[model samples]
Target: MKAVVLVRTRIVYAATAFAELVLWQVPKPVVGCTHRFKYRLAYVVDGTCVLRYDNEAGKGDHRHYAGKERAYGFSDPDKLIADFQADIARWNHENRHP
Candidate 1:
């Protein structure tokens, strides 16, 4: 089968912060991933992408935050979304002004 889009949406959190999520089910796993799903979930602030999760071609499941990259344990689509949202909340909370 061909690639099928599962989710493609942009969530606005504030005037300058928003999230873009795109998920697709491909015929096969990406080059390095073990699952058939390919996804990119990102949270942008101002005009910069400050947080992101992706299973890129050569990189298996991974996430980037605070300018650092790390491996991510991806179990399912539901868990992926949940983890991303949780991180977004953490980021916002840690960066909140007094």
Candidate 2:
């Protein structure tokens, strides 16, 4: 199997708050995904994880928010980026406690 890193990025929202995004592509089947791509996104505040998205081997795709984990649909890469950013924006609006 061939793997490629598509994106690796981090954005700072504040001195103690930040978000990171990592996207990867695989040409063949691997752990946790039948899709050709996998990604992980996370938002942290004051060293605490508040939001995350990832697709682990045999687990498909999922998201975590406010310490709760939920299944997430894995669509195209653009949608993934949009969703991650939207979640961070929502968190910023709701309870940006840091």
Candidate 3:
């Protein structure tokens, strides 16, 4: 079977901020991941990606935020999206103007 794209879209939050999401359902797991889904989610502001979640080859599942990288417990696609959105909210609350 071929890899199928499940989600590929961008969410515009402001003139200088947006979120990009790309998810694919693969025939098998990546080099390090255990699931069949591969995804990359990012939140950018002022031309800088400040938050991201992904499961790249040989890296398994992880997230990058505020110049820090950490392991992420990926449950499902819905939960992954929810967690990413929550992190975006937290980042904006701490860094962006109201």
Candidate 4:
């Protein structure tokens, strides 16, 4: 077995959307998705989890939105960031937030 190594972290705060995020990348991505390492990305708005993408301990990679959860494919780190940004944009647009 290979030892898991910690890699990188990204953080973002979008005041307009009222969200905070933390993303961690490791040796292997969570198993649910076809990608090698779509480890995790999470966003909380006003203390509520508004968006999330992650591979749970054993559940696989998935996405959560406004309390609903679904399967998600994580391809690359950049793409993950882009996707998260886009989702935030959509939610803000729908809610008429800044």
Candidate 5:
């Protein structure tokens, strides 16, 4: 997976050919703007996504599985999306016709 920050805003883009999914997550300003922050989570499965903001209580928590390997992270939404796409691309390249 790959991630990049643009203009202080994190953007993640992902695509999975096997699953026929593409995802994009964009960061937004948190309300109240204290130490506590919130991120809008946008995920696309089979090219469609539902977005929900992470509450303070559930700020960063998620799991991803690639084949038999599992990865866990408390990461920003954008980063996660980018990583997902990169992994899918890499997997497709390695396992499928180019």
Candidate 6:
């Protein structure tokens, strides 16, 4: 199943623990619901992890962790909400109409 949390017109944040990914998106302004600034954070509970952001394109910004380290950075709910809003604004501007 898929879960989506929409913080605003431009931002959407989603998480799928079973799928091992947390996703964030900022949709294009003119495109409205088409183009997006998409990001995904991927990890395995007992394995390694990879945090990927649009900043580096699809190549991804990678980070590796052993067992327990995988649980370290996934606990901030408030920050996640804030990040959604900020990303929305930035993405909207990038796609804004002329």
lDDT of each: 0.95, 0.86, 0.93, 0.64, 0.38, 0.32
Q: What does candidate 4's lDDT look like per residue over 1-98, in tens digits? A: 34342334544455523444445544554555454553556666666667887777667767898778987766666777788779888877886666
Model 1 pairs whose backbones collide: none
Write model 3 residue lDDT over 21-61, tens digit each, in one string: 99999999988888999999999899999999999999999
**Collision count for each candidate, in order:** 0, 3, 0, 3, 1, 0
What CA RMSD would candidate 1 show?
1.4
Stretches of model 6 off by over 4 angstroms after superposition: 1-75
Q: In lDDT terms, how accurate is model 1? A: 0.95
Q: How close is candidate 6 to the true structure, as a TM-score?
A: 0.26
TM-score of each: 0.97, 0.89, 0.96, 0.68, 0.35, 0.26
**Model 5 / residue 25 / CA error / Å:** 12
Global CA lDDT of candidate 5, please? 0.38
At residue 23, give the lDDT of candidate 4. Answer: 51
lDDT of 1 by residue, 7-88 (tens): 9999999999999999999999998888999999999988999899999999999999999999999999999999999999
Candidate 2 lDDT, 1-98, residue by residue in tens: 57899999999989999999998888875476668887889998899889999987787889999778889887788998899889888888889453
TM accuracy, model 4:
0.68
Candidate 2 TM-score, C-alpha based: 0.89
Q: Give the poorly placed runs of model 4, Cα more than 4 Å off.
A: 1-25, 28-34
Q: List per-candidate RMSD values in Å.
A: 1.4, 1.7, 0.9, 3.5, 9.5, 16.8
Candidate order by decreasing TM-score? 1, 3, 2, 4, 5, 6
lDDT of 3 at 33: 85
C-alpha-based local distance difference test score of model 2: 0.86
Provide the lDDT at 15 for model 6. Answer: 36
Q: C-alpha displacement of 88 in model 4, angstroms? A: 0.6
